[model samples]
Target: IRAHHADLAKLLTSVKGVGPTTASTLLAQLPELGKLNRKQITALVGLAPMNRDSGTLRGQRHIFGGRADVRRVLFVAALVGTRFNPVLKAFYARLLAAGEPKKVALVACMHKLLVILNAIARSKSPWSNEIATVV
Candidate 1:
């Protein structure tokens, strides 16, 4: 995989917690990563929360229906991110302190991680601390 096109994969793996497997999974499963905006990318990865409200009753928002493989990989990556990646670690801690459920906070981290990855890919830049502050 590294021999195929090393730069993009290398750029992605520069992020802490995203290993070669996750990077390749991203390359194969999400060829559109760099081409789309945050909302579009998050929805594509099934990380965008969808509201389940009706006319009279408000329902909880939940995420569903997108690339399951990508979502799964992101979930795992986000789990590692909450421990190792500084920005993500801080964000996850903040959410937990605010009383968000562990799963909800992890999902939020997944969303933010994906958005930062999308932006990095779009810009053809290696991972940086600045991406952490975004979203």
Candidate 2:
């Protein structure tokens, strides 16, 4: 797998929390990873919030309908990222400080992590903390 999608897999696993299994799952299951924009990619991975509302009534946005396998692996990676990755750790802390629930904060980290991976893949660049800071 890495032999074929070497750069993509390498770039993803370069992140603090992503492992070979997660990277492989992404490469195999999420072919649209680098091809889409942030919102598009997150939505594809089932990380983007879906609105549950009727006309003139804004309800809580929930995540649904995408690659469940990918989302499942991402959830595990995001949990590790919140502790090991400096940028993600800070982001997770900020979300908690703002009164976000633990699950919500973790999902948001998953979203951010996927976005950063997508950006790196699209640009054909290795992961960098400097670039991650911008996300």
Give candidate 2's whole-model lDDT. Answer: 0.90
Clashing pairs in 2: none
lDDT of 2 by residue, 64-117 (tens): 899999999999999999999999999999999999999999999999999999
lDDT of residue 106 for candidate 1: 98
Superposed on all Cα atoms, model 2 deviates from the true structure by an RMSD in Å of 1.4
Candidate 1, residues 35-109, lDDT tens digits: the string is: 999999999989999999889999999999999999998899999999999999999999999999999999999
Worst 10 residues of 1 by lDDT: 1-10
Estimate the TM-score of every prediction: 0.94, 0.94
Query: What lDDT score goes with residue 135 in model 2?
Result: 62
| Residue 99, candidate 1: C-alpha displacement in angstroms | 0.3
